[model samples]
Target chain A: MSEIRWDLVKQNWVAVAANRALKPNDFPIAKMGLKAPAAGGFCPFCEGNENFTPPEITAYRPKSQANEKGWLVRAIPNKFSAFTLEGELVKTDSGIFSCYNGLGEHEVIIEDPRHGVEFHDLSPERIETVLNIFKERYQDLSSDARIKYIQIYKNRGMFAGASLEHCHSQIVGLPFVPQENSGLPKYYRDNNRCLLCDMLAQETASEERLICKTDHFTLICPYAPRFPYETWIVPQRHCEHFADINEEEVRDLARVLKKLTGVIMDCLDNPSYNLVFNTAPVNVEPEAGYHWYMELTPRLLVNAAVEIAAGIYMNPVAPELSAAMLREIMS
Target chain B: MSEIRWDLVKQNWVAVAANRALKPNDFPIAKMGLKAPAAGGFCPFCEGNENFTPPEITAYRPKSQANEKGWLVRAIPNKFSAFTLEGELVKTDSGIFSCYNGLGEHEVIIEDPRHGVEFHDLSPERIETVLNIFKERYQDLSSDARIKYIQIYKNRGMFAGASLEHCHSQIVGLPFVPQENSGLPKYYRDNNRCLLCDMLAQETASEERLICKTDHFTLICPYAPRFPYETWIVPQRHCEHFADINEEEVRDLARVLKKLTGVIMDCLDNPSYNLVFNTAPVNVEPEAGYHWYMELTPRLLVNAAVEIAAGIYMNPVAPELSAAMLREIMS
Candidate 1:
């Protein structure tokens, strides 16, 4: 039976099935220890674990010996990569739907050879080095005119499908801009202002739902949060490329990140979460009007049917309450 | 460090941070349990649970007494609804951004007060009765011209975030079409063929990736699945409205659902899953050219940073293998 309900804020539809209401105990928290470290002899990113993965494409170490150690950051080909080097970008039409070869580069960024260090735990110097690496890699990959967009992200824990037990992130370059990327930028072009900046301003002015604010960055739980406890970190200024961040801004970004993670851990009992960076297209210039920002989503509730069915969000906790909870922990 | 890898098939960007890899065990799964069911002792959806929720909007069975006994299905207003009947649809332009008042209806459909009954366990006659109920309520909600879309969904386990232990679903009607729904359909319109239809055809043609296919329906793990063991149940025909389904089709739909849920239980040790339906917009005719179907995604893996950053998907197991593994499970 359908007793129809509409989420007014999100304007999404939901039909609650009366036959399957669930209690808290019936649900299992995502088991963190399910995946042990890959047991394939040696890990490619580790100090002595070079043989386990494909040859390293790049590394941040003194150009002394061939591959004998002393690397702060390393780039290696993924052993079980989803995309690879050989295929050409050939598009074939099948009736009305068009598809092409699953070709492209899939590489892993190994932050440190030491197994358990997370991105937030990295020293400020190391974090800056990682930022520089991102800029360098983006410039190199964008040289291929076929590539249209580059996406950078980090999966933190088992809930985020990180099979390996190392603190790392992934970079993917694509041959086309997704509908979301293209459409989002179009909104910017139409309004002649950064969408996120506008949103940040509105959130700051309201202040009722503000979580944390600083000179360089602002963190807030979006009013229409797609997931519960979803937080966004945006620059106070309208900047397109993440790589364009100055040294001072990078440190600010680092501080923002540390505080963001700290709040999440304190508020949600250190729940597993994912952090993603959304920036402008690789080939685009600073004036292209894309907003670069990071979104950190803690896996508090299991997202199943409602999210998948409707594009609208179902955040049970009101944004005001969510902000209040996070604010308490932040202080 | 970021290695921007491009998924040639999906044509989306992916950022691979090998140096920033997260081990599987780093995420701690929330312990499974039932808590909120006993809270305050005013739970309305439970047997004699009528006092906890709002007054009934609709009810089935026993028309003799006024809301007294033996109701097969009951439709009632949500206690803490996201959308309230009191607000007006006042759209305000704040600078350049668009926002509106949270105005609409939110209700719950209580299937059976008895706990522990999975939807698949319901008799076919009972399932048909439920279908009739769905149709009746949908017609009732669509009477208001202001409502644009109606959504129906069921979240099963604690992982799926069901607050109560009783079996039920919620229905919410909205005033606007979501971005994804409005945008994804554009692809279908541009191609003059349903987007999902073409996708289903490809998977059906390649039976190796097919999980279950009947005359009316076909279920398969999608190629380039966003999450592992993600399965889709699509109608064989191009029916946009769920209400268009006849008696036989409803029976078949239930059968397919039961089979898939059985696979999920057996294959992944009864992992919690989300069952979502994407149907045609309420009040809108079927000429819009989109197909209606359900997406069954098991909470097998948390959506990490890579997925959120890049719209591209990274499925570890091939769909063919996943389908085969699922098919082997005895329902």
Candidate 2:
């Protein structure tokens, strides 16, 4: 089983395990397309197509500056980046105004060397290796004084916003931590309890809505689900950082994730979905409470004006019903 | 010009204006061909379709019975709501346990007698009438002592979760205000300044990102846009609630909205989008340093794992560029 940790500074939860699912190849097989490719035909992430993207920032390849030949997972600068790497993180406040230059590193982590191989489809060993790489990157980025937060996430399938078919996630190092994010951990501190930990215990005890569970983790459609089929994967035991899980936990996580994905695929005829690992900021360590976890949002509804107007969500299907349906399908 | 009020409670800004541009036939037009309709389709809110849903609690039609439909905008109970109407709003202290019932009202607002038109395409006069209806509903629902907040919003198109193409937003009156929402107002009170006011001032002053402006409002792409082409419409002056806006401002809003929609349709090639209004809570009255506004999110990018995990938007195009493009195409 994997351990979940809540990052105090960033207020995100992450799962840490060494025995990650051994089967990454199934990642691609479960995806159903809800969106089409970009109008232009060029896909920069594919193999034999190194020229389409900016120069590689870093890669686990041979020391060749020529092309994208010898590489496992590579990191490249985004062609259409929101924030470039050139600016300095200069912070200045004009009276009550406070802001800094949008300076930091935004690098894309390519998971597979080949095209059409999503993360879940990667081998278990490869998945573990990928997890290690993520930790290493987190550690490396935290060392930089200017960087306040490091974000890692993958967009699979067309609906999940995969510009390219290859499996990958992008890591962004930001200069300033977002205000809402910073408030989350403080909330835990003020309440004298870990928000997620308390919530998880309640959800677990109320097993009427449990979707699936593994040795290390439990997957359930949340009571206050922001979207229909919004499944949350929380660790049975609370930990904080994602980079600190053991091998057994990782393996358990892999098993659980595979099953969760399987259930999703089996039901809803393979809807487009997003899988996100919410870990704490690089600067903060796990404390007395708080836990990290994964939130899976299936694109079952469109987020329109009303949703934007109110922060509250309007999930048509009840969480209990969704859980029941998922359990039945998984069984 | 519409007044932009900083919500002292929600920490969000909203514009109160009756200035709206509504052509008689103008309404949100759903894209053709997304999902397969039911085998034997039925209009769930129609007069005879009462049996299709759970017994309605309140209806406005020639009320021989409450559920019977002669109402302009019908409010019926959600058959499969995420949150139930039952359950006590109990906050127990079971050794650091904190979980509340998913207890709240989830009512669907059916817009038209005919099932053909969306809210966006309705006549200006008709839209104003709908706004009145929304205001009436808010006033009525918020009076419930159990309800602390009333959220009003609409979803258009299948992408936006409109089960029926008829125009309407759902109202969910919660027992208590959510933490994320409540914190915004607190931050405002502590800082003694409006967060959105500062944001809008910075954006308007930048001029580089300003898209379109009406006497009552200014539409600009946010500086750090969470999504590509994320346009925000704000009133030039500060005000609070959406229902409090005068008739003139509504007309101005209608014009600006029509122009904004035209630009989105023409410039982004009529991409699917979500329009959300950020307003103050039900109990909160208009106060200094609070503002209300509308956010238009064009679904240009699929918000996948990276965005969810990192809490940062990866915009493919800069706000400046997007604004310029929109300015070129909009009315």
Candidate 3:
């Protein structure tokens, strides 16, 4: 079991997972991104090299068998799981210090069977299949008593933190809720409303920061984005989790998400980016406090040393301006 | 005046300053770091090219005039400052949204007149001179009621966010204290003790994560670090700010910091890194809540897509192991 150590100063938990099996010297010579796919190059997530990865947990197969070449997408346990399935989560508090066993699940959803394929290349139907699979996985693991938060996010390029060139999204069932969702519950307590709901109302009314709106989703550039082209996809229904999103909503979301990402790729010249699903904790109580959404942040600048170290950002571009550019490109 | 907008979801402020004058088109072609300094490079911070930079705010001049040829170190307003000296800081709140004018100070401390020099290349006494200038700047503006926090940090390599090849550190005086300093006040209210002080006691008592301890400073690997080889330098005197340190303490810190950076460079193959000073807000009330410290984090890895997008981190290396390695290298 991995140990989640609580940072006394950060007031956050740091999970020390041994699944990566990294040595002390690995830090000095860690190579990122995939090698060229030509000339006998091997990739674990590729079609013929399925044996290099852990067995498939689930897959969307139309003609072939599990872990076979016919699959369009598949979910596998992370080779180095940050949180494993077999562990007892026992919180230990000594004075002001606290820690717990890292007891949950870390899985990867390989978006495409073909290596080096980008997300935008996938059809809306294929993206819809991926979303459906993600929903199934969320609903599948929500019943587990140990898991509290599930984060589903994608990293597109090396600068965006993708270690491999294969198109994949990660799903991690954490034992506790990370601070990203704290605002919703707190806003509900203070204002008796969902935070994103009010934000949607404000952005829609103004439309200054609005990029585009679909039947079920509203995409807008957040008012205070840390990144240059940071945008959010908020569901109009104010749902608490992605698992709760219906079939129709999922289809609409797939279209909205696909178009937005494509626009970003065209506008930013295909910059590295991260896409995250901000869902409520598993079985959030008084669920009106939360409104689940998807956030896309482009890694526009490479010099984030200041932002990373100080946690203070000096954004060169305004969200209003970025939204206008995105809307222009989107049209 | 630049605008500092509040993020409802992140519960943080985002400053949009014109100092950089970055248009939306710049996002597609912004190059980080610097070109090779070989072909008679024109660095505004270089010794002979001082006229290219904004006029000097202050400098350590045993010879030559202000912004002139001979100076070990100098402080000047950033050519594209994130915050500025001319603006009326006003908070505007409507419903749940809030914003303020980006009215503060952003200065660059050219640590060396020579281009492409590393901090470790400077002598301890020379580093002490730099530290003294940082303290002088901190105390200089701390009296202004509009300024609430001061951040002094260095981004060494391109990966670590340095835009120029010249050796330099940044000093930003903000109109508000950032969330980095929020933990101290919260802990003080709950525990009636400084958080870093308590952490120091635990790390010192165990010495498992201790790298090196001096009379005035204790350098240790934080138990929970977001980055690989992250170390913290906590002052022993329980001071609330770096400006509060004495002359002897400054000299001691300069020596300790120099040694640590040297060891890190030697061990990590001269990895790009960020060093930050976490000082308290100006004139903190019931000052027991804060303790000043410096943190050094190596940019050993480039894939921060997950850490940046989601606030969760899975640190593969444990602090104990990293500290052991550092100690071994130092010995």
Q: Could you say which candidate leads in lDDT? A: 3
Q: Which candidate do you rate higher for lDDT, 1 or 2?
A: 1
Of the candidates shown, which would achieve the greatest TM-score relative to the real structure?
3
Deviation (Å) of B24 in candidate 3:
6.8
Clashes of each: 72, 83, 0
Q: Rate the local accuracy (lDDT) of all candidates.
A: 0.62, 0.58, 0.80
Q: Sort by DockQ, best first.
A: 3, 2, 1
What would the TM-scores of all predictions be? 0.78, 0.73, 0.95
Off by over 4 Å in 3: A18-38, A93-96, A302-306, B18-36, B302-306
Candidate with the greatest DockQ versus the true structure: 3
Can you give the lDDT of residue B248 in candidate 3? 93
**Worst window of 10 by summed lDDT in candidate 2 chain A:** A21-30
DockQ of each: 0.18, 0.20, 0.51
Candidate 2: tens digits of C-alpha lDDT, residues B1-331: 1222222211222222212322212212122234333455666655566677777555545446655556655666666454555656655343332344555676776666555565556666656565666667667776766666666665544444455644556776666554323433654777777766665677677777787677878888755455556688888767766666677777777777656766665655445566665566655453354466777776655555654445444444555667776766663
Ranking by TM-score: 3, 1, 2
DockQ, candidate 3, comes to: 0.51
TM-score of chain B of each: 0.79, 0.74, 0.93
Q: Model 1: how far is B239 from its true place, Å? A: 3.9
Residue A64 of model 2, lDDT score: 53
